[model samples]
Target: MSDTVVIRRSGQAGPTSEVVDISIPSDQVFERLVRDGAVAVARWLGFSEERLADMQLAVSEAVNNAIEHGNKNDAHSRVGVRFIVRNDRLAVQVVDQGTGLAASQLTEGRPSIQNKLDNGEESPRGLGIYLIEQLVDDVELQSDEQGHSFIMWFNLTTQGKEGVDEHHD
Candidate 1:
């Protein structure tokens, strides 16, 4: 149920980066894979414990949405995850095979769950997307003929050795 997935790119001059891809059939595996990627990326970025936990949670929710909603628990379809580390930030992309959402709707924050419930709606989604936006610097959702993808960017400047001096001085 658990595995260490590592992604690597060539021809980079600075700190090395990695991307781990996993195809998970079940919710349990999906959650674990995301957590593993988050841990790996956070460690690679030299993030503090708190930041690592945040990253893990954010990625976990993203993957869950891909599995539960996008793929609809279809075991045949696979979710693609890519993690990239650049000079100043870390980027994670989760792609799922499903009908995409309306881009405009996502851009304009949708009504919250409380609002929907107060209005007498039975169910509501998108709470995770809202949280992802708050947790990371950037979040983008895109879909084409192939599948739907959620791309998230976290600034390394907020964590680890590079930003530690800011607190001290």
Candidate 2:
């Protein structure tokens, strides 16, 4: 499958909110497309440079999880990234076509890097969920038969908007 991106704007005159949705084949190379798309919306929302960096990392990890764990790197499968931009905040959702995670898995304690080393694991690589939570202002997970959706929110603070142009559409 190829990539598909859709942008939708709401409100009259000056739009109050915007939505950007991107779908791509389950390939690691395309993960950047989704991450960049979400970062663009966060930048438009006036997030600080530090926040932008955080968003980039968080989006990357989420997309990586969707591609590696969710889609199992199957090129025929698809992963979707959706960004909802509002005046006050930006919300992102990354979706995958896998069977989805169990509710218990969501509440499990954060993985410990030390434990991985002690257990002789090759790499401490299962920390995506923990890393994403630490970077974003807020995060949540939703799953059904369709798949898992990783939702993240980043709020725009007054300091963040200090120098940004006010005009937006």
Q: Could you give candidate 1's per-residue lDDT for residues 35-63 as a string of tens digits? A: 88679768867888767776787888788
Q: Which tens-of-lDDT digit does each residue in 20-57 have in candidate 2?
A: 77788888888877777767776776666767777888
C-alpha TM-scores of all predictions: 0.75, 0.80
- Candidate 2 differs from the real structure by a C-alpha RMSD in angstroms, to one decimal, of 5.9
Error of 2 at 34 (Å): 1.9
Locate the minimum summed-lDDT window of 10 residues in model 2.
158-167
Whole-model lDDT for model 2 versus the true structure? 0.74
